[model samples]
Target chain A: MGASGKRPGGRSARVRDAVRQATLGELAEHGYAGLTVERVAERSGVHKTTVYRRWGSVEGLISDALELARDEPWPIPDTGTIQGDLRGIVQLVRSGFADPELGPVSSAFVAAAVQSPEAARALHEFFVARHDQSAEVVRRAIARGDLPDVVDVREVIRVAVAPVYYRLFVAHEPVTEQDADRAADAALAAARAGVL
Target chain B: MGASGKRPGGRSARVRDAVRQATLGELAEHGYAGLTVERVAERSGVHKTTVYRRWGSVEGLISDALELARDEPWPIPDTGTIQGDLRGIVQLVRSGFADPELGPVSSAFVAAAVQSPEAARALHEFFVARHDQSAEVVRRAIARGDLPDVVDVREVIRVAVAPVYYRLFVAHEPVTEQDADRAADAALAAARAGVL
Candidate 1:
C-alpha cells in the first residue's frame, strides 16, 4: 500500500503511522523499560484517551509497532549467484545496523526481547517473517545447482547474519563492510561444504 | 586463587565478594534497567554508605561484577581434535545459557551493555579476555594441521559462538544441543574451507 492506503471502514492510516513512528522514537530514546503510554501519545500528537483505548497497554503498543515495522516493504536482493545474493543480504543488514535512527531502535528491540516474554515473541515473529521472505534467495541458488537441495535455507541466512549481530549486540565491536563480506563468505563456505 | 586464598588485607576481599554476589542477584531479579545501588546494598547486607563509597555508581558495581566473573577460572576444552574441541566449547556455552540463575544475569548484562557505555566497555573487555584465553584451542588445531595456518582463529571462534548468542539475544529462540552442534559444524566447515 502507498502512503495514502485506506483501511476498510475508513480508519485513519495516518494516525496509525504517526503512532508507530512515535513509539519507535520513544523506544529508541528510553528503551522498553522506560516507555510510557502518555509520552507516546504526546509525541504522536494523538489524544491520550485514544492511545489508551486503542493500544490498551505498553506491550500492546510495542507489539503493534513491531508488526508495523515488519509489514513495511523490504525487498530481497536477487543477485543471480549465491555469493552475490548472500553479500547483498549482508550489506543490507550492515546498513540497517549502521543507520543512526534505526540502529538504536533495533538495539532497544533486542533489549526488550531479553527482558520481556511479550517483546521476545514479537521479535521472534518479526525475524521469522523476514527469514521467510528471504528464503527465496537460497531456493533460487538451489534451483541453479549452486547450493545443495538438502541445505537448510534458514540456517544459511542465520549464519550469514550472525556475526554482524554478534558484534553489534554481544561483543560491542565495530561492524564494518569487511565484517559483512567475511560473514557472507563464511556462510557460503559452510553451505558449499554441505553443513547448512 | 583458591577458595582459601586471601589478599594482604582480608577485609576488603570478603566485602568485594559479598558485593559482587549481591550485584548478580539484583541483576537476575530486576535486570539492568531496574537495578539500583540501594537495592544492591540492601540485598548485599552491606551498608549503603559503604556501597556508595566504594562503587560510587551502579555502572561501577556492574563493571566490577563482570570483572569478577571474568576472573573466575574457565578451563578451555581439549578434545584432541578441532571438531571435538568446538563441540565442547559449544556445549559449555549452551549449558551456561541454560543455567537458571546465571542465565538471567547474563541477559541483564547484555541489556546493560546495549543501553550503557560503561557496561558495554566492561562486556567488551570480558569477551576479549575470554577470546584470548580460548585462542589456544585454534592454535593447537593449526599446529596439528587440523586447521590451515591461514585460518583466522578469532573468526572461527566467533562463528562457533555467534548462533547461540543470536538465538538467545536476537531471535529469543530455544538453543538446543543440536543447535550448538550445528553451529560448531558450520564454523568448522568454513574454517576447513579457509574462509575464516
Candidate 2:
C-alpha cells in the first residue's frame, strides 16, 4: 500500500482488512447473533452493496476472518526445551481467552461454530493449521533426544491443550495458570510414557 | 397414575415428565436453535400457556432438562481395576456422543449453554454432579492400592474425559475408541507421575 499508493489492488485489500476488523469488533461486542452485514458495512465504511457482494453473508465474513487469523504466524515458543515450550503454548491458550479484548472474540468464534455447520468446518480447518504449527515444538524435542522419534507430535499438542478447552468451553470452569501448566506437563508425561 | 390415583401433584409430575421428554425430543431433532416453547408444548400435548408459565424460555427448558439428566444415574463401571475403569468411563463419554439419538440432545445442551449463561450454570452444576459420581472410581483405585492415595482424583477424571470432549466440541475432530482409550491412559500416566 505504501509503495502502490491507492492502486485498485491496494484498495481491494484495504476494503477486505476493513471488513475483517469490523467483523472481529462486532463479534467481540455483540457476538455472532448480533453480527449483521449492514452493521459491518457501517462500521467498516465499506459500501453496503460491496460488503453484500463480497462477503455474501455473516458466515462468510466469519469464515474469512478465521482464515486470515489462521494464516498469521503464531508465536510458537522456542524455549530450548520441550517442557517449557509446551507450557508456554498451553499458557498462551489460557491467557488468550482471559484477555479482556481478545477473549470475547475467540469465544465468539467457538460460539458461532457450534451453531453453524459451515462455521464448524471453518473452525476445524483453523485448528488443523494451529495444530500443525504448534507441533514443531515436539519435533524439536524429538531432535534433541528428549522424546522418542516415534511420538505422535500432533497428538501431544492436542492432549496438552485439550484440558484447557474442555474446562473453559465444556465445563464452564475457570482455568488458572497452574491448570494450564499442569495440562502441558500431563501431555508430556503421556508422551514420555508412549501413551499418546 | 394408577398408584397415585390421579392426584393433583401426580398430574403435575406427569406434565413435567411429558414436557421434559418433549424438550429432549425437540432438542435432538432441531438443536437449541430450533427449540421453542410452542413446539415443546405441542409435542408434549400440554397447553402452551403451561409450558411458558413453568419453563419461561428456551434456556429455562434447557436448564430443567439438564437438571433431570444430572439426577439420572450414570453407569460408573467397576471393572475391578483402575485401568479398565478409566477406559470404560472415557469410552462411555465417546460413545454417548456417537450415539445417534442421544448425541444430538447432549450436543444441544452444550450448544445452548455456550449461548446462554443460565444454561451454562446449569451445565456447570451438571458436571459437578458427574465429576463427583465419576470420581468414585478413582477413590476405589486408591483404596485398592492401584493409585496413590493423595492423588487429585477429580483432576484425573477431568483429564481423562477432557480430550474426548475437546475432540468433539472444541476442535470438531473425530474421536475414535482408540483415542478415548489413549486419553484415559494418558490421565493414568499423569496420575502415576504425580503431575495431576
Candidate 3:
C-alpha cells in the first residue's frame, strides 16, 4: 500500500512519492533553512533539472511536502460528550507531536512558516483544513445543548491545542498526556462558562 | 543609560550594546537563518576577530542578543483584580507583538528558537522569567478567593498567553486587542471553574 493505503501508481507517481519522502528526510535532518533542491534531488536519485523544473524552488517543494504529510484523513472522534471528544483530539495531536518521524518534520514546517510567506500560507491552509475537519464535535455539542450557540467552535479547538503548541515551541517543555488532559479540560471549562 | 537604566560600565558596555543592537537589526532584516557573524561585525563596526572571539559562534551571538533583548525588567501588572491584571499583561504583550521594532525582532527570536537549541534555551529562560514576574497576580487572586487554592497559577498565565502566541506563530493570523481580551477572559473562566 502507498501513503493513502491504495495500490502503487505509475512511474511518475512513484517518482513524486520518492521525492516527497526525500524532502521530508531533508527537513527532519537539516530543517527548512538547510533544505536545498540539489540535496533533495541527490537523496531521491532524481535529476537536478527535473527536481528544479517540477518544484521550481525550495518553497514550492516544501509546500508540496506539507500537503503530502497531511494527505491522510484525520479521525474525528464522537464520544458523546464535548470533554471526551476534546480529550480524544488533544491526545491524537499530542501523540503526533511525540512521534519521532513526524515531530521534526512538523517543527521544521512551523519554523519555516514563521520565516517564509509561502510556508506560512501552507501552514495556514493545513490548520484550517484540520480545524474544519473537526468542527463536527462542536456542532454535535451545540445540538446536544452542551454549549451555547454563541460560542465560537473554532476558538474552542484553538484553545484546546494552544497550550500544547506553547509548551512545545515556546517554553521548550515536555508535553505529557497530563498536559493534553489539562488542555482539553481547560478548554471545556471555558466553553462551559460560555467564554470560548 | 545602560540596559538596566543605570550607566555603570564604560567602553566595554558601549561596545556590547552596539554589537547587540546590530545583531538584532541583522536578525530583523535577514532572519536567524540568514544572519551571519561577518555581517553583524560590519554592521556594528566591530572587527570580525572581535566578534568571533567574543561570541564564538552564531548560536552564541544569538543567545547573547536574546539576553540583551530581555535584560530590562518586565512590568508586572497589579490591577487589584485578577481579570484586570490579566487584561493589562495580555494587552501589553499584544502591543509588543504589534510594535514595528519589537515585532520583527521577536518573530526572529521565535524562529531562531525553533531552529537552534541554544536559541530555544534563551527563549525559554526569557518566558520563565516573565511568568515568574507575573505570578503575583494569580497569588493575589487566590488570596482574595477569586480562584481556587488548588488552581495552578503558572498554568493560568500560560493559558492567557498561549492564544496570542498561537495566532501569531501557528495560525499566522493577526492578533488584535479583542483577541487579547478573549484570551484573558477564557483563561479567567477556566481558572474560575478550577480547571487551571
Candidate 4:
C-alpha cells in the first residue's frame, strides 16, 4: 500500500494494516501452527466475521501478509566494492533471521509455504520481488566492470544467499556472520570464475 | 540397520521397518499435514496401540523414518575428478528429490523439521550423517591435491547442495539439472580459490 506515497484509501488500508500487524505478531509469538483466524481477528480488533469474510482462513491471512511483505522496502547495499556489497546483502539476510522479532515471522512464512500451496504461491511471488531487488548489487558490479555482463546476476544472488538459508532451514546449522561472509565470498569467487 | 552387515534383530526390526515404510508411504501420499499414527498403523497392518506405543505420534513416526534413512547406504561417488564427483553428488541429490516416490517423503521431512522440534533434531542428525558422508568427495579431492587440504569439506557439500534446496523450498523455483551442475561447479570454483 505504501509502494507509492498514497494509501489505498483510508479504512480498507487501515483494516489491512491492522490484520497484517496482528498476523505478524501472532506468527512471531506463536508461529504458523498456533495462528488462528479467530485469534488474529481478536488481536487485530476487527470483527471475527469480517476477518472470516475477508481473509477466509489462517492460510489466507499468511498469504496476505506475504504479499504485503513483498512491497516492503528493502535496502540494497551499494558499498562501492562488489565484495563488500555482496557480503552486506548476505549478512543482512543472516541477521534478519537472527532478529528475535522478525525471525519467527519470516520462518513462519517459509513453514506455512511448505504446507500450503496458496502460501507457496504467495511466498514465490514474494521471492520474485526479493530476488529482483537483491540482484541490484550484481547488476551494479557488472556495470562497474567488477563482473562480466555474462554473469547470471539473479543466480549469483541465489548462490550467495542459498547457504545461509540452507544452514538455517535445511541443514539446521548455526550461521555465524563469518559463515555468511564466506557464502558471499564463495558466490563472488564463482562469479569471477564464470560459473554463476 | 543396513549400515553394517548384521540386522538389529528379527521381529522388532521388522516391525519398525513396516511402521517406518508405512510412515513414508503416508508422508509421500498425504504430506506432513496428513500424516497420522492411526493411518500409519492401518497401513502397516500393525495394531493401533502397538503403533502408538512404538511411534507415539506422527512426529515420532517421521523422526523414526528419518533416523532409519540416515543409516541407509548412500553410494558415495568415486569419480576420479573432483568436478565429476561433486557434480555426481549434487546430481544424486537433485534426482533423488525429483524421484516421484522419494521426493515427497524427503520434502515431508524438511517440512516436518521446520515445525516440530523433535523432527528437527532427527532431521538435523540425519543431515549430520549425510554431510559427513558426502564430504568424502571433498576429502578425496584434497587427498588428490585437486583442492587444498585447508578447504572446509562439509561446507563445500553444503554450498553445492544449498542452491537446490533453496530453489525447492525457499524460492519455490524449478531447479534444472544444469542449475544443479552449476551449483556444484560454483562451490568447486570457490574451493579452488580457497574461499570455501
Residue A48 CA error for candidate 1 (Å)? Answer: 1.1
Q: Score the docking of each candidate (DockQ).
A: 0.72, 0.84, 0.73, 0.84
Q: Which stretches of candidate 4 lie over 4 Å from their true place?
A: A1-8, B1-9
Question: Tens digit of lDDT per residue, candidate 1, span B1-196?
Answer: 6544555657778889999999999988887878899999998889999999999899889899998888877879998988989888888888987888887788888888876789899999999887777777999999998888998888888889999999888987889999899898999999998788
In candidate 4, the second chain superimposes onto the true chain B with a TM-score of 0.94
Judging by DockQ, tell me the better candidate of 3 and 4: 4
Report the lDDT tens digits of candidate 4 across residue range A1-196. Answer: 3554364566788889999999999999999999999999999999999999999999999999999999998999988999999999999999999999999999999999999999999999999999999999999999999999999999999999999999888889899999999999999999999998
Arranged by TM-score with the best first, the candidates are 2, 4, 1, 3
Give the range of the ten consecutive residues with the poorest summed lDDT in model 3 chain A.
A1-10
Docking class of 4: high
Task: State the lDDT of candidate 2 residue by residue for A1-196, as single tens digits.
Answer: 3765757588789899999999999998998889999999999999999999998998889889999999999999999999999999999999999998899999989988998887888899999999999999999999999999999999999999999998888899999999999999999999999898
Most TM-score-accurate candidate: 2
Better of 1 and 2 by DockQ: 2
lDDT of predicted model 3: 0.86
Candidate 2 residues B1-196, lDDT tens each? Answer: 3767657688788889999999999999999999999999999999999999999999999999999999999999999989899999999999999999999999999999889999999999999999999999999999989899988999999999999998888788999999999999999999999898
User: Which ten residues in a row are the worst by lDDT in model 1 chain A?
Assistant: A2-11
Q: Model 2, stretches more than 4 Å misplaced?
A: A1-8, B1-8
| TM-score (all chains, Cα) for each model | 0.93, 0.96, 0.91, 0.95
What value does the lDDT take at residue A129 in candidate 2?
97
lDDT of 3 by residue, B35-108 (tens): 89999999999899998999887888888987875667888899888999998888988898798877877888
Native contacts retained by candidate 3: 0.72
Report the C-alpha displacement of residue B169, candidate 3, in angstroms: 0.9
